[model samples]
Target: MAHIGPAYGSLAANQAKISAKRDPALDQEVQTWIETIIGEKFPNGSYEDALKDGVILCKLMNKLQPNSIPKYATSGGSFKLRENIALFQTAARAYGLEDAELFQSVDLFEKRNIPQVTQCLFALGRHAQRHHFNGPILGPKMSEANMREFTEEQLNAAKNALPLLNEGMNKGANQSGQNFGLTRHI
Candidate 1:
């Protein structure tokens, strides 16, 4: 056998083998970590559902990494990548993960800027979405009407109260006065 240097053709073969073994292990770790986060976030949630959320969380996190959070219009309107985190966290907590590890990882004081927390949450949410863990969490939709007129404190209160109120939408919730698009009425 000939000695293959770094530039040699063997490098591709070696790299492939390494990646093959590493990918699965990395995915397992991600799965476990997501499970832990989801478990803490949604203590009453079923194991199966939590597992699904975990996978989606991983996908969302990946999107957040390297600066790629989706810009699709959300309940909060046209928010940037960072603000998307806050929106996601607000929704996540509403879905029953108030003490989610994703929030715990952020340090309010250390991070300083509000964007930091938002970005972190966005990243985490992105990761969650990537693995097909995310789905429609049953809860009252935060309409743009309220989001625009409400103060930050008021919005926070609503986000906080969402988990307590109910899971999923309220069939009778009115949307005539909704400030954003019809879809954003949620």
Candidate 2:
């Protein structure tokens, strides 16, 4: 249902916020990441223009996870192009990107919110690194899980030590009713 109470007043402000987030350096970095992952350079266009048709992105998904997008349009009508974008989006979701991390298809297809498009790419790159995509690293390496198993005796000893720790912590320190630092004066 179309909402009559949509926040129209803040639309421009939100647009400005998104626009401010655009960084040419990040665009270049993301472009490099995509090109490296897909192992192909754009024919002749800006990063946004190169990815607008979604062919590159679909290829990227397939490269990361074989057959992610079984078939994508190399060139065709608008509907075909949009389908390519949609397939990429679906593959991204299936590949483990949170909804917030994925950009809307229209963002790239219509060239709106190119910053978000770049943001989505960076997120994907980071996630791919986390998932160990077996390609050149994209973003920072993901930290590995460190799990420590404690014996029952160790757990019991730690539990019994808590009271001793709390006693020392509560010996004489407190801020229950004390004001810290100078209060601001009007």
Candidate 3:
């Protein structure tokens, strides 16, 4: 019988490539925090564990883009919620994500697509940083001038960060036997 070496070599290879482009220390630190959060929050956790824990998800989002969750939370009142909906819709359109894909409903936590949601939020946060968007939602109407201001390094960093974000989500989901999906929604 042929020995199959590492059934998931592709995942390992992708992780290694991403690690090469980023600071290993930072990666380790973030991974460690994610693991700790999972251990504390979901000892026998499932994908739903991470999804349902808004605090944990917000913490991760804050690390990706400071104050993002708080900004979203502070936008109180029905009118503000509607405004945020429009803002996110515009931003999602700019990011080429479907309007339905917006992380609007808490019921989204019930979906099996937490990894996709995590990636979307991560991308939106990166876009917000590049555009100096300070809205409650990570999405803000983008202009060509704003897009032009993003450096190649910044763009590449965002691209590279996706896998890391996915890996963190995978770590949490692992307790529940759910692997992060690789489908690129953005």
Which candidate would rank higher by TM-score, 1 or 3? 3
Cα error, residue 133 of model 2, in Å, equals 3.0
Higher-lDDT candidate among 1 and 2? 2
> Largest TM-score belongs to which candidate?
2
* Candidate 1 residue runs with Cα over 4 Å from true position: 1-28, 31-79, 100-186
Cα lDDT, all candidates: 0.41, 0.83, 0.47
Q: Candidates' TM-scores?
A: 0.21, 0.78, 0.29
Residue 13 accuracy (lDDT) in model 1? 75
Per-candidate clashes come to: 26, 0, 0
In candidate 1, position 70 carries an lDDT of: 39
Better of 2 and 3 by TM-score: 2
Two-way TM-score contest, 1 vs 2, winner? 2
The weakest ten consecutive residues by lDDT in model 3 span 105-114
- The CA root-mean-square deviation of candidate 2, after full C-alpha superposition on the true structure, stands at 5.4
lDDT of 2 at 119: 79
